[model samples]
Target chain A: MTITLEPGRPKPMPTPETKHFWDGAKDGKLLLQRCGDTGRAYFPPRPFSPYTGTRNVSVFEASGRATLHSYVIHHRPVPGFTPPYAIAVVELEEGPRMMTNIVGCPQTPEALPLDLALEVVFVPMDDAISLPLFRPAATPAAGRTGVSMGVE
Target chain B: MSYVPGSVAVVGAAETTHLGAVPNLSEIGLAADAALNAMADAGLKPGDIDGIAWVGAMRPQLLAQYLGITPRWVDGTSVGGCSFMLHVRHAAAAIAAGYCNTALICHGESGKSRIAGAQRPPEPATLNGQFEAPFGPFGPPTLFPIPVLRYMKTYGVTEEMFATVAVVQREWAGKNPRAMFRDPISVDDVLNSRMIAWPFRILMCCLVTDGGGALILTSADRAKDFPGKPAYILGSGESVETGMISQMEDFTSSRAFRVAGPEAFKMAGIAHADVDHLMIYDAFAHLPLYGLEDLGFVPRGEAGRYIMDRNTAPGGKLPMNTNGGGLSYTHTGMYGMFALQESVRQVRGIAPAQVPDVDISVCHGVGGMFGASGTIIFGRDRPS
Candidate 1:
């Protein structure tokens, strides 16, 4: 029997290694693991801290605020991406770098100003989970500019 | 312990089945084929190899088991494209410190067949896959295309200027019977090939391939007695930068190469002018262009034009990527092993398309998207 796999669909069964991350997405929060002893935030959500040699690291919700450290306007779609998207490395105010798409805004190289303030927006996927994405926050000038949607 | 050069000499190099799509060979079979050839070439038995370094793209332990050898020292440094070159540097250090007498570095891939029904290993620590892949980045082609535009924007480089490098390398591939891409490609053909990403034509990207290659490295003292001519490891260097693609300082510069190149030259005790031939990695076309600049082959932002005028192609003053390259040659996931293998051939005076009077050849391997770097400088016993 052949089972067809749908593209862009979340896995029907989440593995134990990825369960926590998927669960956090369901609750509309970006979760990061921090070592309880050192308070150092770690990614990929490991259960142990290689730094402090401590086990049982704690997982906590990251503040939804981040600053756009840098970004690239990619025009090609790999396996899962829409063409002409922005992949940005956002530095969380809480002290760790996260890679996320700069969405809900114009996707242009000019829109990627360094250190731009951004607010996290959770995008639900197939009703099973949400991906953590960021959008430029509303500002006096941002609102006054009539929300420029594209690079003119 | 920190690695000091001079203890390593590449004694043997070999490749598995080449050309056409090969589906019958398992990944392990391909690796063993290459490893055994390298061992036979080195005039050493499998039992003589105490060190084994392999790119982690394939199953490492399976390769060891298939070869019927358990190594005293093993490394699976999978930085990306430069995996094999990096292993050479690490193995050299290990050999010098009396860790092993003979070292084998190998890579194998069945990418051609894997394309239909391959499950990529779940990525654990990579932010690029989780966050960036969901959006787009088109792998290396899409990610690296914009950078060339940025390079052109800052340097006034034309598309034709970049095509010169591609065209010349294709010409070189015509001579190498093992190269998968042997047909002559012209500058116009490169310009006219359908664009994958703006500023990057389809011709500019490497072809997906399935093959394997291996190298044997031993102490310089033992190298004198090896079966073939020895390619001495004059210098080697490695470096890593911020892994995030977007966090790089600029599109035109590879900080990893910038940091690794100067130090590699320093350790080799040579300058760019002294290099008789170069085997800079060509994961993408612009990579070699930029790498040449970082290696001081030309002034910054001038590699494309320099390649055009100097004809740094196979017959040019500085022949580069003579065995095709990652771009025109087989890019079986990782291409660094091929670069080192070609360098060994060039220095040994037995390259299928040998460039005469080769005294020193420099090979540069880049992993990730300019995220990691490993450079090796090889010198023949006598300077040309």
Candidate 2:
């Protein structure tokens, strides 16, 4: 059976608070906001420090390094995704977690162990949009190529 | 403040007359049907209900209007599938505080048919839409399994141990004539089922059905007037931790579950050994494992073994998910209502898979991906 990916997958609508992060992804940079007062960094790029409710925050370029916290290799067909792909949550080096897919490795338990080192790879979806997916940092040669560039 | 144990009781409880596939009833219609059935069970009328509570698609006003009643107190606490459990807690508190005399809590979902309306598409700019949605996470099947996988790795929980949950629940399902899928399943059956997500197969997921359930609450003193045997609300607890699964305090343990379970146990002044029947909302196979450990029924990391040993099966010491649970019974998106109904049935000695001489029952629920939790303890006899 020829698997045609569903086209209705959701895309991020860039709001003022989150536009910077999306723009950063387009520029091949992983951007996270740091609270100016507490120096605590957070993910999903919020408007303020969730811990202290401080509006004093600024964006910084992330190291693009993260550890695989947890994931599931979804075999069911989802819109904009082929069957049998990994859906993962990775904890960034800066002490915050973000949801992303782990690319560049087999979507198997043996290949995607807990705390596996991963680096971000920018997959461009459109002229102004790109998504940051993760791949095992050590296996650059195994990185996925020529796949559809859309949300999972 | 700690709850006054046994101040309120569930006078009536019921699910829709026909579960699984009822294409005739819309989501709201199912809610009304269940509410009417429950009211009839309690020998009550629409005018007798002074408070109304519900979660998911149907609003309280809409449900009340459909039933031709205007409630003075209303609760629409949508904390995912466990919202109905929270409704019971809130209704008990409202009844205790004289906010309302008779409280009706209802839940209805057309999860299989999508007849109520298409599922709401997430706003792209919302927190989940921005962070989690972009990753192509496909609802609970994709998101929930991630944590269970981690839990397995951390606790040495094997695939066979996970399959035991589905197998045991199916055993309970086989006994219930109303259960959607009642065929007995083995561990090998669950293991061999088609994989939906890694470490999760078709057997691990709950059934998609269109149904609803309702419960009526009143002061314990008025319980004897109702035709149905009362399941006295001994204690209740509720808590929320996060909206996203990725942001949960820990993948293995749900903070909300930890807080909700012990609080109910403390309020009821009951020990773990006192629980005669248990209903842990089993939307997925791994949920009961978390519920068991978090509710202090077993030690952390031992629930997998506890199930594998047939401790929660039909003839086991602790009868759990006696209505076949969301797994094999009816799951209309929000499954807590059915869990509550089964607990009441077990306490009243009318459950299809009835456990003999049950006196106390605990109904524990998880909303979202461990986002919220509500736990309620029920007793056959009123507290002194």
* lDDT string, candidate 2, B11-126, tens digits: 99989988888899898888899999999999999999999997744577888888988898899899988998899999999999989999999987888877774367568879
**Model 1 alpha-carbon drift over 4 Å, by segment:** A1-152, B1-5, B57-59, B115-126, B382-384
lDDT of 1 by residue, B45-145 (tens): 88888888777744566677778777887888888878787898888888888888888888777767663323363253355545445544556775555
**Overall local distance difference test of candidate 1:** 0.74
Q: lDDT at B153 for candidate 1?
A: 61
Pairs clashing within candidate 1: A81-B135
DockQ of each: 0.17, 0.65
Model 2, residue B68: distance off in Å is 0.8
lDDT over C-alpha atoms for residue A130 of model 1: 68
| Chain A TM-score, structure 1 | 0.75
Q: Which candidate number would show the highest DockQ if scored against the true structure?
A: 2
Please report the interface RMSD of model 2 to 1 decimal: 1.2
Please name the candidate that would achieve the greatest TM-score relative to the true structure: 2
TM-score of candidate 2 versus the correct structure, residues matched by position? 0.94
Candidate 2: how many backbone clashes? 1
